[model samples]
Target: MTRSVYVTGVARGDGRQVVELGVMELLTRQVDRVGVYRPLVHDTPDRMVELLRSRYRLVQDPATVYGMGYEEAAALQAEQGQEALTARLVEGYLRVARDYETVLILGSDFAGTNLPAELGVNARLANECGASVVAVIGGRDQSAESVVAEVRNAHHAYTNLGCDVIAMVANRVGQGVAAEAAGALRATLDVPVYVLPEEPTLSAPTVSQIVDTLGARVLLGDEAGLARDALDFVIGGAMLPTFLPALTPGCVVVTPGDRADLIVGAMAAHSAGAPPIAGVLLTLDEKPPPHVLALAARLAPGTPVLAVPTLTFPTATELFTLDGKLGAGTPRKAETALGVFETHVDTAELTGRLSVARSERVTPMMFEHALIERARADRRRIVLPEGTEERILRAAEVLLRRGVCDLTLLGEPDAIRKKAGDLGISLDHESVQMIDPQTSPLRERFAERYARLRAHRGVSYELAYDVVADVSYFGTLMVEQGLADGMVSGAVHSTAATIRPAFEIIKTRPGAAIVSSVFFMCLADKVLVYGDCAVNPDPDAEQLADIAVQAAGTAARFGVEPRVAMLSYSTGTSGTGADVDKVRAATGLVRERRPDLMVEGPIQYDAAVSPSVAATKLPDSEVAGRATVLVFPDLNTGNNTYKAVQRSAGAVAVGPVLQGLRKPVNDLSRGALVQDIVNTVAITAIQAQGGDGDRPDAGGDGQERTEGGAA
Candidate 1:
């Protein structure tokens, strides 16, 4: 569904760009489609318009999202009550959002002193389209008192309008202010406080938010409206009726059949003689009270009436008991934002995660969606495992759907379609290529690539084609020969099972020999990247150096630059053995080969990673502590250590997001999670976009690049 966002406070040019994309990132979390509007702009000749022109595709007129850029706003200083002007410019803002599931309404930076007709009308328009308001405060100062005053004032301001202040967030504050600001907001505010950490900025669209917003449609609830900002006002119909008092004027939600009293009382209290009833929600196969409906018809006739089905009123009521408190400053703050969004958003949880734990800038020229689109190829061949026809088609053709990748699914046309129907995945043969290996044009191509390698061994061309084609090896041949840009397999195959075919055909990328596999071990909020899992069973120090370099590069591409800690059982200058020696040698080799990289090893995992241990072990080393990438001396140490971490610690292990093939070739573990498949597929698509000569999707073909998955 397309989402329309009304972002305000984007006065500065860069700040405006940041929010434009930031809002897009926020919407990408839930809404697949987007239409952004700015009912008004402060100033500067169409900065918003120019920004829109330079950056995003429009679902509506870009001018409507923002009117009167810097110069224009200044030009029309006398043009107060710019409703006609804004409405004229924003041609289809309402029309576009009218059909959308979730419309994101961004608040202008009026600072509460401006007229509501200008701001309130904009906010009210969101309600007109069944949208919610996400109000972000651009902190002009660090004085804690100022933030408190502003939030309290705004809360009362919005509350008096009979609108629930859905969420509260402080933006542009220095990272230092997070702890105290969050604390203050928690103690003072009745709602959750979210710190849009100084990291993740506004570069990429947040997939988590996109998925949640989109999936909210499936929920059976008393009210099915989105919270523009979960940190603001919260009113769950099925939750504990704890918000009875907050239901003054702007917002009130109640199950029509279950809580007739709430519906009647809230409406009576808020809309006496046509007071502002910002959001009047009725849920569960029920209608408003007859008298309440009669009263509403005469009073706030235009207020949005939200209705949802499925959940029982009492079961739904349990949600309102949440503390809604802001958390202390931590890396998980962003994760918390995601968590909070999931709970409050009317969408399904975005199970897919681009694991990032710290604050950093997202570089330019690399866009996640564009890459997803670019990975969709129109004329590509792919091999699908027997019954995975549905997921395979969905994933393989993400590029094709978005005009990115050419998808090929390896299966019989009838069989694949039948399987898709069984799995409840709507797929047509024309949408994707269902190539049956038993009889395909690539049959001969596979025979040629396979025969060139396996001919000496007693194998006929037809037999070679059949054998290679049936196994994933032929898929590898397809990728190597440019018939396909990448390959995703291992649904029914083991780690080694998946890589064997790719290894035989895909070969390693340029500049490296050793193929290493790394597992993205996410222990909830913390992400641990461990390498040398799949490929090099026994790697020398030089080969280990390449692996470390490759792994670190991969980490950086996913927006996590590597603080590499080359792992061993020992610490700095401690144990002496072939193992430790190899690790130390690898450390030296990495320095000699890629000195710009952050690498330190020949240490225990704790000593290499934790600051506490590092202080005692390698006090002055750059990468001794807080390492992002783990470089293992050999396959045994890399694979076993990662596996131990995955099983014993119960980490959510995501493989090999990257495979350093000539293209984006990645192997899936036999028992991989659906999330794992989604993430790896995304990574592969990104990597594939980087290699496609037809388009420079990455920074001139900039996307995540992988190396050494041992295959």
Candidate 2:
């Protein structure tokens, strides 16, 4: 039977999308094939379905996602009566549900639809579809008592209609009152009730959304800047000095286009980091002169400069009504929504109540989810050296928002703050710790320690003092001196600059021959470990064996089973060369060192990965067809192969994760994205949990395991 969950709301302002998105996340985490079905939708494109399809990588066709538009359903219900409407909705839903293990059914939004009693309609469809219900009630601008009554009333309404009410969510409740509302509901209702406080940022409109709402022309600002949320609107009617102080963080400045003084002043204030204004909106369609516009661009590079034909009063009126939405374009909003939902909801209890069966396969999304959950379970402090980089700051916001790990960003504190403010990212939380490498009190101490550690190599105290002030060295010293648990860098710095400090200070772990690196090749269905891809040009047989062992341990630490395949140009003695001989020798050394390990020698890539090829080439070998840890013969082959698979096979390559280190110090590519930084930081925190040792099964045992193709 296909398990189904119906998320419907009692009113239009319920903010039920948050509940729906959270449930979709929970479903994807537990199951491999999850389907989405919207029983009724407006004529506009379905934003929630698009977001789910993109975020979860769903293969369901867009045409099949929605049963019919609101007009069509309303007409059908009017012409043929309620029975025909119910039959049509059920048939459409079953068409989607039949192919998936579980389906998420989105109920109708009570917006402008001619259909009568939308809530009752949703309940009827849910009952007919045999789906459990998650009822969402709007608590916005309502008292705690009022919110509680509404939740109770909604539960009764659904249950009276024969819908299995699994849970009730009071979304957009006022701050400090969610606890009260939740307490009152729990006393009266038998089902689990979650209260999600209203998030102002979620409702704040982005600059891009403002442009669309007013039909304004954007003369400046990059995509990232346009995506920033506008928290407040400052109508610029006063003098430059008076207008400057009114500018707040994420505020948009509205002024006449002829007032270059106000425009320049606002941009200058934003550049000086008084409080990062969202952007400046010029009204009356009067653009400044080209020279002044160029100067404004120089003052704030990515700050949006928009022009609208309407006067200041009309533009402000429209801006007042514009609200940001959770859609395909706004991913940061989705993260914020998830963070808010997860904070107030007891997801474990809710999932248990829904009785969702966990899937055995570990897809890429599932693996990524596990990484974050495990890291959050045992929170650790990680230092990012590239503190002022835009991507790093954005990723830092996500990390803090998700409660993934505590962060120690190494840079000038004021500079980092100014950059974060410009990007509308708040570093005010306790989880974020900023430091200036040049002026930190620990600098002298780190200099002394670094000098002592490198004195044998003829490094003087003065030189060491200068070197320790660099962010990379400063971060590595923090990890070495126990100030931080791990370090992830190389976003703006070179890989050599990032890891050289680690090699000098942290050094290699005990019994480790040399340090190596591995990339977690996240294929569509599984994860494979490719080692020595980013380190070591060439190695002898002993060094190759050590790399293989280190890579295997890394694979197991992150929940990948290690069936070692010593990759070469040949398979099972079918070919001979110097490369083949080295692989053969390394395989022998691995079996000798770890007699219990499953390993194959001099295996070709085809035989190592394909069951049919293994049957013909090495039928008797256990590791030939089921290898999870692939140790490349050299760095050249490993690096190229991982990139090939990443591009050609559309795989997600997650590392260059440095192994064989005493403490966790991972490096990133120069072109790493914001999510890449987040993933690397999580990996570093997990590694810091004392799993990077010779024991291959150190972190693997007793940990929650999910089966899949990758990580």
| TM-score top scorer | 2
Cα lDDT tens digits for candidate 2, 284-314: 9899999999999999888899999999998
Candidate 1, residues 1-711, lDDT tens digits: the string is 333444443222112233334444444433444455554455533344443334433345444444334344333434754554445434545654555444445445453324434445545554444443444555544566665566566556555655444555555455566667767877887755444334321222221222242232221111111211122123545433564555432233435445656555554543342222334444465665567566644433333344555354542354233222111211122223332332222221111121112123221222343223333332333434433534454444333332333456676666664434322233442546666777777678778767776565666776776676674766666666766666778777655666666555555566655556677666633566788777667788887888888888777665466888988888888789888899898899888988898788887889777899899999988888788788777776677777788789777666765445445567777666554555566556666655422221221211222223432
Misplaced by over 4 Å in model 1 are 1-404, 429-431, 456-459, 523-527, 647-651, 657-660, 691-711
Q: What is the TM-score of each predicted model, taking all chains together?
A: 0.49, 0.94
lDDT for each candidate structure: 0.52, 0.87
| Candidate that scores best on lDDT | 2
Q: Residue 65 of candidate 1: its Cα lDDT? A: 49
Where does candidate 2 stray beyond 4 Å? 693-711
As a whole number from 0 to 100, the lDDT of residue 205 in candidate 1 is 21
Residue 298 displacement in candidate 2 (angstroms)? 1.9
Clashes (backbone N, CA, C under 3 Å), per candidate, total 69, 8
Q: List the lowest-lDDT window of 10 residues for candidate 1.
A: 220-229
Task: Report the Cα lDDT for candidate 1.
Answer: 0.52
